[model samples]
Target: MTDDEAGAAPDVPQEPVTEPVTGAGAGPAEPAGPAPLGLVRTPTGHPGVDAHLERLADADHLAADGHVEVYEDVHRGLREALTALDAQPVPAPYENRS
Candidate 1:
């Protein structure tokens, strides 16, 4: 072994390396919209259902483009509609699942 290699300490603690801090426009860029709501891909067997899904996706994308408030309003409307649908009279339940 060389004299310098033999003399170096084997157990010394080294300074921890860190990633450089990012300033404005330095880090990874991101999409400028509310992330996708929980829409899942349905089986492509039904033509009518597939067409409806495509139309919904197109409208959602358009709403996301520089119109976040409108997108949120659509979300609210959807929620209200779902709530109203559930509130409508239904057959009596036999027992509570809870």
Candidate 2:
């Protein structure tokens, strides 16, 4: 084995099929028409949150795995942001007395 060849990174296996990610609640019985996210209030001002909702709304078109990965990526990032807030001190509320 040559020195350069032995130290090279290994090839990662990738699935040839471009399957879309779907929701975890979905199953083999619900392949045709996934399901609604059951969200009460959508179109929140937050871009990330709105994108996540849009992804969920379009989950039916996405492959089961793909939907899950996208969902996790969005929520995981939001979760990180939410958790980060706990570490920082909260600002005092403004008092208005007129």
Cα RMSD, each candidate: 12.8, 17.1
Clash totals in order: 0, 8
Tell me the tens digit of each residue's lDDT in model 2 across 7-71.
97667797786445566643333445555556664587877666655665555566676687777
Which residue runs of candidate 1 sit more than 4 Å off their true CA positions? 1-65, 92-98
Instruction: Name the best candidate (by lDDT).
Output: 2
lDDT agreement with native, every candidate: 0.60, 0.67
- Which residue window of length 10 is worst by lDDT in model 2? 25-34
Clashing pairs in 2: 20-63, 21-63, 21-65, 21-66, 21-67, 22-63, 22-64, 22-67
Provide TM-scores for the models.
0.29, 0.38
lDDT comparing candidate 1 with the true structure: 0.60
Kindly list the per-residue Cα lDDT of model 1 for residues 58-89, writing each as its tens digit: 44455446455554555665566567779999
Error of 1 at 35 (Å): 20
